[model samples]
Target: MATDRRDRTPTADPPATDDEHAAHLERSRRVWDRWSDWYGTSESDFEPIREAAIDRLDLQRGDRVLEIGCGPGVNFERVRRDIGAEGELVAVDYSPGMLENARARIEAHGWENVRVLRADATTVEFDDPFDVALATLSLSVMPDIRRAAETVYRSLVPGGRIAVVDIRSFPSGPARVLNPLVRRFLRWYANWNPDGGVVDALATVFDECEVVDTHMAGTSYTVVCEKRDAG
Candidate 1:
């Protein structure tokens, strides 16, 4: 097995200040904007696994759900179906190109309940507390996972749930050899940090957190967390 990079290397941390983070966000937005067409929102083979991640939320009718980094709104319909007409869906993404696609999807479906907002996940001011949230393959790309996690936790109602499906470093077995390639590909493709603390940050902020499971050939892990009831 390969040695743990955590033990031998100290990679630079993400932007710590709001300005730096904003710049980082702009860079990501530009990247996505330029490539949004190539990275279309069409369905894929991983749809089932992604749906499984949403399933972890156990959405109910009339629930208010938030989707962070909701690229192109591919999951919008799936979520709206669960939430029904009474429920509201707020999907946020920084990329204007992506938001355009999302808005198109919403209009095409005539999903009056689904709303798209163009804002950064870490700083977006949510007008209301959400009942459930889902972040699919999006948290790892965030400039600051801890800040993003804090924002998500703060936006949820007491006892509200969140399901995050993200990539994690393949730590064991023969797959360890593929870590370097995987890391490079993900970084180039989306600036994703597979070694990031998305789960750890959420676990620290949420009262109850669990790794629901790993999917996509063990390349992704789904974490479910619940905000504690108000004291």
Candidate 2:
């Protein structure tokens, strides 16, 4: 675990109006709907990173888990395997097409303990807290990464954990040479900067944020973190 010592306060964009935010969400949903079926086709290489991030979540039997942006339920099998039948899974995403695909996957597997909800992860509220949370390839595409991260922080119980796997556009040392190409490609491919201070935002929201792994010339990474316990 490589500790992040950068400034905890990542720069924030000005708040968007309600209509602007809604339009943003709608646009993102449409893009995801278009990409949902094909997302895994091009992303097969990331399987190991995703697996490692899931492992860092430190899942346990009967633990309740929250998966933000649970795109097409790609993670359900492994996560369910970790938590078992006694556990509960609540996965949320804003795209109906993606959720439909997820539902189909759920039905195919006949997973009884999993629930899928279509909602904006940034604003969705829950009455029950989660033991562990996951956000893989999701936060960087969000309109407000900090707000979404804070929401995840609030959704967790004291001492809960979260694992995130996504692009790391900014890297120091010799890897920094790829920064320009990385950011450009992300914007062109995803219409957003996916790794924009995401680890920093998580650091601000959680007690600890560690870069557990980096891949692809240091262009992407996995982050694992733990929320501080409230005694």
Candidate 3:
């Protein structure tokens, strides 16, 4: 069996200082911009998992949805289908190149209900609340997972749902042996940390959380959460 290149790795660097964090964000944006084209074509293997995450959102017709780190708008069609013509989909990403690709997709498909915005997921705010929010294979790449999760939590209306899918470190087992090669591949291609504490971050903000393990020997996990009533 072939192994995915997103398994266990070394620990991520400690939390960044304000200035250092800003620089890291900028670098990440630039890297995605450079990789936008290839990323869109090379990630076919992740499509099933991505679609599974979207399905867990349980979106309804006319629902307002927000997608963070929506690279190249890969999930646009599926989301549009779920939400229908009356619904709205907002796809946000920090990389201009990636957003450009997403825009092209929207134009080609004539999906007027879909909008793409260029912004950092951690800092962006929405004036209107969303019914559902999704972050697929993205939370691990965020500069500050907790802050990003908080932003998403606040952007959703009470009772809204949020779903996140991301890579995680493999537990001790035969799979552990593949860690070094997988880590090297991820570091070289995307600068992503498999063990980025994404689940813990979401748990801090959501009223309830359900975790599901997927892919090779649980190399990745998805978390689905529901917003609690504001007291």
Candidate 4:
């Protein structure tokens, strides 16, 4: 079962007011801005986990996809390859520094189909519905995971697919011993709270949700779901 393990050291309770949420958002943006340059380099080891998430996306040559919190565009190459020249990839990040890296990556590769925008995933608007939506290691950091998931769900067309890969609290037993160290590492590096209720949030928005434990003794999970037709 999933547990709520949000970091209590930083704030004992979740934000209760708009001002508090705004403050947390600003702090998170600043953290990512400072870490943008080293973000990709630091996460090199987790490339496979990201690849696994993208694989489940099952992108096709002409599919339009939306990627939330696409820091440094780490998934760009694989997404580009799968989506091909005909498809469109819309990537959003709240951090300008992160978007800068993503833009640079796109320019360097001459990928015309990929567009990077600086916007908060919870409130960003899409002109067209997407065929697929993906969020890798990002949902846990959102100011409101449920809002973000709902936004993603609304941005997708009926029958559209969504995938989310994120970290959660470690399971009990020997793995429980490593929680403190792992939590500290995540807090210092990504400002993530593993108790964000990501899976629960997704379940509320998507018609069907499937979760797979991806790594670190059930500390990470991959969720795939499909939007059902309104009819």
- Tens digit of per-residue lDDT, candidate 4, span 165-211: 88876866677878888888877777775556787777766777778
- Stretches of candidate 1 exceeding 4 Å from the true structure: 1-15
Question: Which scores greater on lDDT, model 3 or model 4?
Answer: 4
Candidate 2 residues 54-90, lDDT tens each?
Answer: 9888789999999998989889999999999999999
What overall lDDT, based on C-alpha atoms, would model 3 receive against the true structure?
A: 0.81
Best by lDDT: 2
Candidate 4's error at 106, in angstroms?
0.5
For model 4, the local distance difference test gives 0.82
User: lDDT of each prediction vs. the true structure?
Assistant: 0.80, 0.83, 0.81, 0.82
lDDT of 1 by residue, 1-231 (tens): 212222332333454677867777877888788777766644575578779988888889999999998988878889999999999999989899988888988999999999999887888887788999989878998888877887888899998988888887685789889889988887777877555577766766667778878875677788888887562
Instruction: Itemize residue pairs with steric clashes in candidate 3.
Output: none
lDDT of 3 at 188: 57
TM accuracy, model 1: 0.88
In the predicted model 1, the residue pairs found to clash are none
Question: TM-score for each prediction?
Answer: 0.88, 0.89, 0.88, 0.88
Q: TM-score for candidate 4, please give it.
A: 0.88
What's the true lDDT of residue 33 in model 3? 87
Q: Give me the displacement of residue 78 in model 1, in angstroms.
A: 1.0
